[model samples]
Target: MRFHVLTLFPEAFEGPVRHSMLGRAIQRGLLSVQIIDIRSYTHDIHGTADDYQFGGGHGMVLKPEPIFDAVSDTLSPYPTRDRHAFPVVLLSPQGRKLDQQLVLELATAPGLVLICGHYAGVDERVRTHLATHDISIGDYVLTGGELAAMVIIDAVSRFTPGVVGAADNVQEDSITSGLLQHPLYTRPSDFHGMTVPDVLLSGHHAQIDRWRREESLRRTLENRPDLLDSADLSLTDRAFLAGLGYVGISSLLDDGFESQE
Candidate 1:
């Protein structure tokens, strides 16, 4: 897959795109990142891409003309049908929160056009008329969308074929799995006072699997209980969690979890 990043600061992406798995993916021709300077599309002498808000806002808003023109010029070579289905994502705090599901969805697209909003934010027209997806990395705000665009690229790239070492491992990742992952342990079974779980040392695959399952449940219950609401649970899994005081969804079905009842 290909990612066309539209940003005022194209230089910010140089280091990131040349290192880590993203770099490896590019080296192997599995993925590609093209950085486009929004300023390059501006018609002004100074290449002005941002301007003072019309309603007298505190910060300057990114102009719509440059962004629209940039996107048009970037996708001009693609077929008409392909351009219509292309994803033009705008990074913003007010957008839908990014998650593993969204990353997976974006991976299905042949390419992505990411617009990095800066200063106050992108002009409203870009959000309403041009962008197909408006996404936020988290609830917190950032100084610019450059970092968020990198994050989206990394997250979505992991879903691309051959990007990660084991493609199936991505599915079992912490949030992608729909629950927190189980603890991981490597060589050196004994680390001072801490020791690896005995079940892991044993050669019993069934027992080891069971231990991992329960550990994952235990960790999720302690760290993120909200995930339990939609997590896939079996009778054995529910019973295991119930012993640890986690209320299963089925148990709450009769009363609907209302404390009064």
Candidate 2:
């Protein structure tokens, strides 16, 4: 997969994407990232990318012309009447909440064009006319889109095929399956007064699987019971959760009602 990012502060990306899985993906030729300076496409002699808002605002808004020019110049080779066919994502507060599922989806795209909003934000014209989709990390606001872009890049990069050693590593990842991962223990199986679960040490694959599933349910029930409502559950899973004194449909519905209230 290829990721093209347009930003005013291109220097900010010098370190994060240069190391870890992203760096390795680049080295292995499994992924590629190109950082384009939006200011470079500015028509002004001073390379001015932002100006005071039209109707009066607290901060300057990024000019749309430069953003459009930068994206257009970068994606000029691909011919697509539907702009969304290529994925032009703008990081903004108004965007859909980005999650693990969305990350997995983006990782499969042919390429991604991420626009980093600055000052106040990109002009509405840029969002409505140039961008295909908008994504926000969470409900909270941030200082700039650069950090959000980096976070998104890192999160999605892990899902790219061959970027990680094993496909199952991410497939079973927390939130990917809409459930948290089972606990993991390494050397020093017996630590202090705590000992590793006997099923893990017993070398019984069937028993170990049973233990893991139960633990995953327990953890998710305690931390994020909302997931169970949408989780792909089996008879065995339901029975196991029930045995653990787990609350099912009742708790799930209650959470929903509380939220609406």
Candidate maximizing TM-score: 1
The TM-score values for the models, in the order shown, are 0.92, 0.89
Per-structure clash totals for the candidates: 0, 0
- Runs of candidate 2 with Cα error greater than 4 angstroms are 79-84, 192-194, 250-261
- Error (Å) of candidate 2 at residue 203 is 1.8
lDDT of 2 at 216: 86
What lDDT does candidate 1 reach at residue 28? 100
* Cα lDDT of model 2 by residue, 1-261, tens digit: 778999999999989878987888898998888999999998879999999999896998999998989988888877665344678899998998998778877877788999999878889998899888899999988878999898888888887778888744876877887788899998798899798888899998988988888888889988988899888777677766666666555543342222222
Candidate 1 — which pairs collide? none
Q: How close is candidate 2 to the true structure, as a TM-score?
A: 0.89
Off by over 4 Å in 1: 251-261
